[model samples]
Target chain A: EPEVTQTPSHQVTQMGQEVILRCVPISNHLYFYWYRQILGQKVEFLVSFYNNEISEKSEIFDDQFSVERPDGSNFTLKIRSTKLEDSAMYFCASNAEGDRYEQYFGPGTRLTVT
Target chain B: GESVGLHLPTLSVQEGDNSIINCAYSNSASDYFIWYKQESGKGPQFIIDIRSNMDKRQGQRVTVLLNKTVKHLSLQIAATQPGDSAVYFCAEIGAGGYNKLIFGAGTRLAVHP
Candidate 1:
């Protein structure tokens, strides 16, 4: 089965530093999304991207966060200025279409903001 | 309008026993529901899913039951094993937009030998 893959399984960065988490979704998948889970907390939605534009985003997705699909297979999430509160596991997911099939999740990138 | 909730925070089960994790969703418009398992340091893994049109859907060892009237959902794992220990989350996707997934807080399942 094709899986979503994320780079930098673990990332360590100081406060106010810039960090970029990358993901390569399934080749044939069309919809992509980014989510974050604080330690011992519920997983929260960040943003959803399709057709090279963001369809929607949650309140947690603020000016500091941005997503880009630089290439056919590469999707990246950039945090312009990291905060300690941003420390969590960032996951990338993808699905074939709208709400029909389940979205497959990546192994995740653990962003550690210190 | 999108809030998926779990009835229990944690569940302890023994090997060979069946484990059932329950979820309740308030959005009656939610047409698709999914069950995901997340390890200690990993992301949510897709276990099974059910659409609103269907009342029940079954996978290899997992089953998803959806009750639209009450807006409740449940996942049943047969013959639970030690490796099955993890945090399970129930997510729902609404009909109109693709960003409709509302995830539950999650339930931690500990399967002991």
Candidate 2:
């Protein structure tokens, strides 16, 4: 089965540095999403992207965060100034339809900022 | 505001036994629910999902039951095995655009031999 794949399974960056997490969603998927799971916390939605524009975002996705479909196959999340609190498991998901459909998740990129 | 929560934080069961993980949602407008399993060091994997219009849905050895009135959802796994041990999360998509999912705290299921 085709699955969403993310690069840099684990990332370590210095505080105040920029980090870009990359994902290649299923080729045919139209809706892409970003979520983060703090250690021992529930998964939190960050943003959703469709048609090269952000559909929705949460408070957690503030000024420091941005998403881009840099290419036909790559969906990426960029954090301008990484904070200690930003360290978490960042996941990328995609679906063929927007709602009521199963969104497939990638293995996730563990971001560690020190 | 929307919140999804699990009834239990952890559950331990003997191998070959049945396991049921329960969840409750505060958003009455949520029209879709899903259960996901995440093993350590891996991402959440889709288990099964149910639409608001359906009371029950089944797949493989797992079954999903949704109660719209009480805003409850449950996943039942029959003859659980050691491999079934994982953290289970219940997620909901509220009615509206984008269909962003809100996830519950999750319940850890431990299957013992």
Candidate 3:
């Protein structure tokens, strides 16, 4: 089965530095999303992307966060300045249809800020 | 202002036994619910889903029951195996195409062989 894939399975970055998490959703998927889970916490939605633009975002997705399609296969999340609290597991998900409620999730990228 | 929740945090059962994971939701308007299984170091995988219009839906060895009046959902796994050990979460989405989801803390199931 085709699955969503993410790059840099694990990353470590300085507190003030920038980090980019990459994901390649299923080729035919139209709806893309970014979510995060803090350790021992619930998965929180960050933003949703469609038509190469942001469709919706949460309060957690503040000024420091940005997402880009960049290319056909790459959906990326960029954090301008990482903070200690920015460390978490970042996930990317996609849905194949406009009305389909099912979303496929990637393995996730573990971001560690120190 | 709604939430999806699980009744138990952990459950253990022997191989060949049946397991039932329970969940509760506060959103009366939610029309769709799903169960996701997540093993350690992996992402959440879809198990099965149910709609408010229906009371039950079954897939493979798993069955999902939804009680709309009480706002409850349950996943019943028959003849559970070791592979069934994982964290099970109940998620609910509101009425819409792009409706966001509310997830429960999750129940960790351990199927011992």
Predicted structure with the largest lDDT when compared to the true one: 2
lDDT tens readout by residue for model 3, A41-101: 8778888888888988888999999999988989999999999999999999998875467
How close to the true structure is residue B110 of candidate 3, measured as C-alpha lDDT?
Answer: 97
Descending-lDDT candidate ranking: 2, 3, 1
Error of 1 at B66 (Å): 1.5
- Candidate 3 per-residue lDDT, tens place, B16-111, comes to 999999999998989999999989998889899999999999999999999999999999999999999999999997444464666898999999
> Candidate 2, B74: how far from true, in Å?
0.8
Tens digits of lDDT, candidate 1, A43-101: 88889998889988989999999999999999999999999999999999998865435
Candidate order (DockQ): 2, 1, 3
- Which structure is stronger by TM-score: 2 or 3? 2
lDDT of 2 by residue, B4-110 (tens): 99999999999999999999999988888899999999899989999899999999999999988998999999999999999999999855578688999999999
| lDDT score for candidate 2 against the true structure | 0.94
What is candidate 2's CA lDDT for residue B77? 100
Candidate 3 ranges beyond 4 A from true positions: none
Worst 10-residue lDDT window for candidate 1 chain B reads: B93-102
lDDT by residue for model 1 (B59-100), tens: 998999988989999999999999999999999875458654
Specify the highest-TM-score model's number.
2
* Comparing 1 and 2 on DockQ, the stronger one: 2
1 or 3: which has the higher DockQ? 1
